[model samples]
Target chain A: MTPHLSITDQPVDVASALAAVQTDAAGAVNAFIGTVRNQSGGRPVRRLHYESYDSMALTQLGHVVAQAYEKWPMLQEVAVVHRKGTLELGDVAVVVAVATPHRAESFAACQFIIDTLKQVVTIWKREEYEDGTEWVAAHP
Target chain B: MSLKVALFGITRDIVGTSVIELPAPAPATVGELLAEMRKQYPALGELRSCAVAVNNEYATHDHPLRTTDEIALIPPVAGG
Candidate 1:
């Protein structure tokens, strides 16, 4: 099954990611959603601004999903959706869903996809506090 | 030769531009390109980690660069 990967400036649709990975033959489906929180590093964050290198981010997402497929060959479907733009607190930032023949495979693949995507994807986020804004993890 | 380097995140903020054109006779490799960029824009040198991507793929310092290659400065990523 082909993996569904996307980068958008709008709110991430969690249902669409889940639906994309729905397959009758799969017995287990797992999903991981990342959201913007109210605080960071002891500072109260008002919002977040995400940006991406568009094409490169998608390409890296593809590579991450491919690695998961290679590790879990039984994976029947996969979907990764990441949002880039100004997002308020509690907004969905990213979603990773995977369907496999067993629960173990689904869970493992889902975790791997999100973790790898964080490290490799060409995307960045800036934290907006009451006083100032700083790019998250940009320096170290 | 002219080379264009795309910037994103902090690099964009530091350079104050989305894309920048390298001077004529561009650097020959990723390492040289980064060095040249840091010299031109000293603020870029302060980043704890910076990566170079060539044609949408992470490239090593020794990787040769061409004028037509899609070069980008990738700062530390924080994507979820």
Candidate 2:
């Protein structure tokens, strides 16, 4: 099955993401969903603004998926979606799901996708507070 | 030959533009290009970390750049 990897400006479709990784041969599926929170660095966050380098972001996401396939050869299907633009508190920021013959590999692949994506994907987030705004993790 | 560098996130905020053009006779390599960028835009040096990508792939400092290559500044990523 073709992996569902995308960066979109629209709201993330969790159901579609899960469906993308569904296969008859799969015994277990694992998913990781990331959402915006209300606070950061002890300050109240009004919202979050996400931006992407577009082409390069997609390329990096593809690389992450490719690495996942190499690490988990038993993986049946995978789906990863990240949202861009302003996001309200409690809104989903990203979703990653994986399907495999066993539960262990499903969980491992899903976790690996999200973790590696956070480190490599060319996407950024800026936290907006009632007082001001600052980019998340833009500095050490 | 001039080179156009794409910027995003905080780098765009600091540079005040989405794209910056280097003067004629661009730097020979990625390392030289980074040094030239820091000199031209001092605020870029303050970032905790910054990476370079050439043609959509992460590039090392020694990666030689061609005139037709696509270049971008990648600030510390926070995506989940």
Candidate 3:
């Protein structure tokens, strides 16, 4: 099967992804990108490190697509990319793309994937500050 | 008796492992389990915004824990 979900540490290529989408068939394409921020809890961030239990993490990512398909029958395809390892501020951390016949369904599915990913997916990030480093626990 | 608890992200890195086993009579709730972990692993005490999931779902602090249940510690996500 063509895997619709992926988890990686490398940078994301949004244009290539957009180029691959079958725009002819997909009337709408909605994509969401997550990037590292400059601060967390008002503290300045130098960099961030992300880690996960690879196998289990992939399993949970697959579940997100399954849930999306179940909830939005019209959804055609989904592409998910998650980065791991050390990342500096302003780096891309995660990307979610959904294609459907309509814009509304694509938007809904993309939002659900990202919002729920924060709450469900087993990925963790640590914020490295100038003074020290701390792991972030929730999406803010 | 002991139960295995999987810590991830900051928790694992701080304690330095993916799985941790607690002494018998594991805490009844997820929150209590976290408290116990803090007492055992000093680094866990530094986390104030970590999230807990029972199996794969984002569970509440009141979520019950069992010897056989799968528990995961999810730190913040920065994926885009």
For candidate 2, the TM-score of chain A alone relative to the native chain A: 0.97
Model 3: per-residue Cα lDDT over A23-137, one tens digit each: 5668998989888889887888998888866666777788877888899987777788888888887888887888889999988999998888776577777788999976565
Docking class of 3: acceptable
lDDT tens readout by residue for model 1, B1-80: 98999999999999999999987888999999999999988988889789999999999999999988999999999999
Better of 1 and 3 by DockQ: 1
RMSD of 2: 0.8
Per-residue lDDT tens digits for candidate 3, residues B1-80, read 46787877667777788888778787888898878877877666665566667766667889888777777776655443
lDDT of 2 by residue, A23-93 (tens): 99999989999999999878999999999988998899898899999999999999999999999999999
lDDT winner: 1
The lDDT of model 1 is 0.93
- What TM-score fits each model? 0.98, 0.98, 0.73
The candidates' interface RMSDs, in order, read 0.8, 0.8, 3.7
Instruction: List candidate 1 stretches off by more than 4 Å.
Output: none
Q: Which parts of model 2 are misplaced by more than 4 Å? A: none
